[model samples]
Target: EGVAAFVASQGTLSYQLEHFVDSHDLLGRSVCSMGSSGSKYISSHEDSDSAQTHEGVTVVDAGTWVSEPALWVEWTHTGRLESVGETRIFVIDAERMFKALLHPGLRAVATQYAGEFHKRVVTAKPPLASYPSDIEVPHADFCGIVCCMAHPWRVQIGMHAFRKLAAAGGFGTGIAAHMKSRLKHEILTGRSVLVVSG
Candidate 1:
């Protein structure tokens, strides 16, 4: 399942997942280009016993990759989005989420995720941060509070999403939504804080 925000419905063959960083410096600029080619079905691991198409991808400056001796391994490096801040930051698996969302037959899961996300968007408090961190509170921590909040600017993305970011107009600036609607529960077992309006 690929976790991407279809900010615009324009007819473009671009799969840019929403940026998952808090960097106003990168606003309105081309970050980088990304490419995903896991179908080549080449052996990733050195040992054939556990070898599989490890979702390897190589860089293509001319929008094309030349088959060379260079071995492409799964690596995630973010220089542009990495920065220190006073606010607590939580790191989430942006790459895995996108892989799941972009999967061919996960349309139902993608739709559910989108609807659930949008529902949380307009709420007084929505659980945003997940993973290991001190400030990373869960929905169960503050369920049914008068309000909830997350730094709308901060998000985490993988190399796949980063590659597509520059072309998709420097991440998603605006998220669309309908009139106020009831938020649905997509996750049930997670323990996170939920804020409610007072």
Candidate 2:
């Protein structure tokens, strides 16, 4: 999602423009000519230095001109793929698909609505304007979501699922006990807990 947003913002174009301008030598030829001509117009006595610099710039500048177009084409393809992947993920996850389509800053409301939609008791669609108080707060953006999936609302949801699994003895007692405690800590502090797996 973040990559799609960044590419959509045209930041890649801005970066490429800056890179081109910095690498292009505006005075390379004339400066090099002055070295052999000993032109009075040129003030610097270091003819050898200027010629050497011009030679290097010519190689680098030519390479930049040749490579940049191909790189830009590659990046365009990459950005498109990223955007496509983001769209597909949203499509498969009905809840996130709905949330992504909602007005900016209303992600929490969208999530609440999707939850209601999934309820077995919901025979008809709920009103769009009203949502449960528990989900009134905004949810995290992409990076925040990656850093911690344990948003307060998500923690509650996980707790419910975990309890069901525990009752079914899906996990060993010690592992389940440890996870239960961790969930409690996350809810109490409203912070992410890292769980690394090999």
Candidate 3:
């Protein structure tokens, strides 16, 4: 089945199972453009009749455009032409492709083999530091507190209803637990705390 049909029937695509297939001409052309020589790298003994080696590996910057669903991955290469050759673009389905890109085993392998490839390619240096400066400022003071005062009777009745519900175990205990944990964590972390005061 086509990807669209599969997605519609399954309600979601398993990004992990996606694969890219390219002809040798295309692959060589892409690699050459990147200024790198292209050759299948495999151990001699590892090649077996039943096993398909490197069938599922997705190549980035492969000079392929995906127009059906409307997606593409931007890419670039760094290094001299002698060291690193051409950079080709690869088409990708953005939303559905993230799972494939972020697969656990693939992530570890990419990290090790690619050697900080993620950081090298994805990291952006912090903006240049600005020097501290002091200048006179116009005096403008505006202070206001939003005070919502509920009627005493209404507050009492609401509290009474909450107490009854809690006592009966009819209230959502999970939500309360989560809130308590969050509040405690905030307090321990010395973060600004906002309380909904009744």
Clashing pairs in 3: 33-86, 34-85, 34-86, 35-85, 35-86, 61-88
**Which candidate do you rate higher for TM-score, 2 or 3?**
2
lDDT by residue for model 2 (82-196), tens: 1211111111222234446666434653355334322311221134222111111123122233234335545554455556666778676667567767766774465643322
The lDDT values for all models are 0.23, 0.26, 0.25
Give per-residue CA lDDT, model 3, range 1-198, as digits (tens): 111100111111111222222111111111111112222212212121222236532221211111111111122111111212332322233335434667674444323423222222223222321110000001100000101112332233334444565566754656677774554455344342222231
Question: On residues 1-198, what C-alpha lDDT tens digit does candidate 1 reach at each position?
Answer: 211211111111222122222211112211122123211112221111211223431112221111110111111111122112222222223334445566554544334433333333223132443211111112312222211222121111122233354355643445323211111111111222222211
RMSD of 3: 22.3
RMSD of each: 20.1, 22.2, 22.3
Point out the worst 10-residue segment of candidate 1 by lDDT. 64-73
Per-model clash counts, in order, read 27, 0, 6
The residue-level lDDT of candidate 3 at 46 comes to 18
Q: What local lDDT does model 2 show for residue 13?
A: 13
Error of 3 at 15 (Å): 29
